[model samples]
Target: MAGTTGGAAATAPGKKGETPAATRSGALKRLPLALLVFFAALLYSQIQPPPSKVPGAPGGPPVTAPRTRLRDGRHLAYLESGVPKEEARYKIIFVHGFDCCRYDVLNVSQGLLQELGIYLLSFDRPGYAESDAHPARTEKSIALDIAELADNLQLGPKFHLIGFSMGGEIMWSCLKYIPHRLAGVAILAPVGNYWWSGFPADVVEEAWYVQFPQDQRAVWVAHHLPWLTHWWNTQNLFHSSSVKGKNPIILSKEDTALSQKFLDRTYKEQVRQLGEHDSLHRDMMVGFGKWGWSPLEMENPFAGAGDEVKVHLWHGVEDLFVPVQLSRYISKKLPWVIYHELPTAGHLFPAADGMPDVIVRSLLLGDE
Candidate 1:
């Protein structure tokens, strides 16, 4: 009767299916293959890097260099990347940040100007890279070096200047001193926010002395920039989040999700490395007080300068080091300047994903 009713579940003892060992064996055999495919995809993605140039790039004309010297006898390193002596309307000078080599900004300027037929020159700041450090580094002294570099390079009567981070402060000094010489200027993530801070300059400056009383001028930055970059990053990010304007483009769902994950992971890793340095307290004080406030003090100089100097400013609304609030402050004060509040960028540009394009376009095409 059972045989006639015939259900496959009616198995005998010897044929009671294969043992669990067989199931375990099958999974173990396939595990290596699955991992191999996963890693292969990752390797393939890395092999093909992003395109090296912007869309519709008409490469710049050939460049030439003529021998020149600085008055201070300091041998400055520079590369001339456009047809020199060709009376171009604008000769652009790029100024880098503290402790940064010329190579840092060169990597950016070279690409843009090389493809756009624009004149660009970048050099190491004193105490950095190949350029000779000043016996004493001060706002005024550094400005002199830059002005001299421009003269030596014989860029042009009309020139544009772009500066980033600490370089922004230096750029301001140069702009103020050489008011008649510049045709335009652009500041990226300029760091002097002391005026906007709740604390007074005297209080802020005094705090710096306490934190780094003996180490004011000596070189003291986090050896590992990627790790110690958080303090700076945080300031920019907090500022970026606060920007309000006419219908800023919102991130798509996929980008929003992916960005959140990346930000969380990056922030954690950066914070974890923070314990290695004990200099944060002093660094912040000197940075916010002295280094940061210098530019705001010079803002008044732009008032009476002749010539229509077009100024363009772009900063991530999410920037942590230099907040968007600072950008907003400058935009309000300098009526001639146009500010673009980027919705999804951090402090690192020209190297970060979306920022390099915004920066280059802003510098090249104005605020539109």
Candidate 2:
């Protein structure tokens, strides 16, 4: 091969009437192109996007469907599944996670909801899905939205609550403010509050170190500089939360597939156009902010319920998004929370097939 290449090179210079100087000139000309390619690749590999400016739409287009009006005049778009309100033997409210809306309910079977007489309602939080944005939304205020939503619909004196991921983190607010109105509560694979002072140093260290560096920065920014939450998530020059990425805060292949439905292109563009202040950013700001109390400081919320009011906490053993160690610490501190630590599951465990039935049944029908 070497002899053949040398013969071709010799023939090309002689037969083509090309001078040695010309050949050298051609080689020199190609050198800069190669360098340009190398440098372009180097820069491409190093460059990254910036965090958003205050965090915009959390995705899913504004709801075009008729929306229910809360007393405060803000509107919420919701989806209802299973039995009608009156025929419902079990009325449950599902709080969706970050970057999702009313459409992203659990993978529960219609047969199960019908057979069990379960009426599940999922709604968009203010500032998402055409739900009127609440400029002054706080942790307590958002929780009140849930209570008022129930009251407006007249969902009787009490209803069951199921919160997934970010939904689960804020579920604490409901436990704090509206425990009397809850028949039961199920928190699934909740996003842990790393800034919560209740966690031990070792537990916090273990969980914080396991997170992807970008997510660590995201948490750090959200906790320390709440004002920069949007920019920290949307800027084009730095790493941000996986919330808007291909693999959100999930760890399993099953969860990966579950996330695609939320990360659709058309869905993203639709919501991005609204340019509303995002409820999810508020979730991050309040989620890591000083809540004045911690779940570790919580008494059994169901302690005084006249009827059976079970509080179930389901977490995945393999969950790295929020780490099982933190959940373990929480369960230990609040022993009344019935902890279900599933083996080999990840952050999106709540979306697994047949899991919804399991969670609801455990919450209402007892742990049969």
Candidate 3:
């Protein structure tokens, strides 16, 4: 009886097993599947991200505030602060940087603006806020838009411009394209372009290396493969902006704390209102795109204008967003610009308490 069970279990394995020849054939049968899987994975690895699709009308709540019409019939929305335009002794147009909107201006005191008679104008750039998106936006077109806005507002022939971060970067566009329309300009912690041919190779390399790896790739895509920009930034699977609103590591510890004074939730909410395509993506395209001219190549727009004209650049040595060397090079090239290097500050220094007032005073009153 035991033999019956043992015979089945201990008999030659061939009782229930395939022959060596059969096994060989089975392995051969699996070869195509193995190869198919291997090739499929290989192709997947080489595949690029799909191109970005057109973003529909923005998703945020409708903006109820006033909007100025541009030359091309696009409505440009803005936030007004401080004194009335007629009563304003100092007319300031504040420009916001990446991942920001019209409301991103420094939280300056109404009392301060009142006492100084300041009219602060902060506007959403094309594709931001309630402003109409411009598919053909270019560096020169943006500068002209600001100039035309001034004419439409009767802010006089020229107005003071104060821009920070990417906003600071756009001041260069005005300098290049519409300097005659500017009374004075101030740029704080502006971003720099790595592809600027004028920079010494070694210096540019050093500055470029300081950026976070993600930012380096973002910049590379923005400058080199611009067509992939929308997908690179929107796919969210890989690429995103370095200056992530509140978590921007590019700023210093102190600057991060200082920035807390302003309510950023609204800023971020409004920033995304128009989608990244027209705002951030367009910013990268125009900012890092082939500008054909660098800050080094620009002429001193205020050179012969005496004390009546001024160009101020404020940079902090502690800034990781824009390394000190880049600003130093700009200062060296444009000797007429009053360059202020803050030792302990970072990129967001302009947002510090009382700091906005100080910057305004310097521009309007000088060293009085």
Candidate 4:
């Protein structure tokens, strides 16, 4: 009797209809909303809804686990994420440029390679990541590194090589040093050709965008959006409907504002020079000295890579990094190559769409 108000009586808020049972019922009734708020926060954390990854910002492809070191002393950091079926005609080895890593191409490339059952191998070049850097490395030395990797991986005698930017020069050295091993080659925005063809203003500007990471904020505002640089160039590369109306042309006013900010940030982040210690231009200069510069030379792995071996060519029509005219002119000279000009694309190809299929068809569906 000292405290009849002890325990349940003390804890309970007996205010009219708000009995302990009634309060419990009210909490239960609101549980779903509470759960929803919790789940909504979780969902928001998982997906970056609209216009974050691509043009429309819709959720894009799933991220796959890239393979790291498999064999001991292999030392190369590689991504062998795509499934390689026995029937997969050949594995595609992607070589990234100076100071660049596998991430530069991996995000956009996985879809196309996976769809066609083609295996992909992208690794941080020596010195960039796990691999050791050779000072002022020549294309020959880089090619040796690639050859060593291929041999270690047992990719077989008929692998295809796809090189981007400075990587193309490394590939040329591979071809020069070990041509018989490769079945085909695809070069994207290579350096040597641009020297002969004359770089487009937009492409040079874009390269500057790539070279100067800090200038992205000002350049992006000047260009209006990050992807706009590609969009404006794509207009010349493809017909309007070819890209399935995924043109950046139709950006809404709100998106335009957001996109400009997005672009400004992305350009800054993307322009990192990977292997600056081993300048890509120096490799070219030496290779140029050895091979000698000519508008047409059999010394170019690209010049001879066309016939017998399958080749797929893509360059932005308005590509300021490399000339579309060079891409066209080169493809024309080579009878065995298939070329696609992205009316709205800049230097980079839209890997999500049908780009890989085109490469596969070019490789498999020949006169056979």
Instruction: Look at candidate 2 and tell me the lDDT of residue 19.
Output: 66
Candidate 4, 166: how far from true, in Å?
2.3
Report how far off residue 220 is in candidate 3 (Å): 0.5
Q: Model 1: per-residue lDDT, tens digit, 110-188?
A: 4555565667677755433334334344556666777777877666566778887667655667766776677677777
Q: Give the candidates in order of TM-score, highest first.
A: 3, 2, 1, 4
**Which lDDT tens digits does candidate 4 get at residues 259-355?**
3432444423322222222232233334333343332343444454445665556566644433456556656665545566667555445243555
- Put down candidate 3 lDDT per residue, 114-143, tens digits, no spaces: 998989998888877667778788878888
Cα error, residue 169 of model 1, in Å, equals 2.1
lDDT of prediction 4:
0.51
lDDT scores in order: 0.51, 0.76, 0.79, 0.51
Which stretch of 10 consecutive residues in model 4 shows the poorest summed lDDT? 48-57
Per-residue C-alpha lDDT of model 2 across residues 36-66, encoded as one tens digit per residue: 9999886554433222222224543434655
Model 2, residue 227: C-alpha shift (Å)? 1.0
Better of 1 and 2 by TM-score: 2
lDDT accuracy of residue 240 in candidate 1: 18
Q: Which stretches of candidate 2 lie over 4 Å from their true place?
A: 1-63, 247-250, 257-273
TM-scores of the models, in the order given? 0.53, 0.79, 0.81, 0.51
Number of the candidate with higher lDDT, 2 or 4:
2
lDDT of 2: 0.76
What TM-score does candidate 3 reach? 0.81
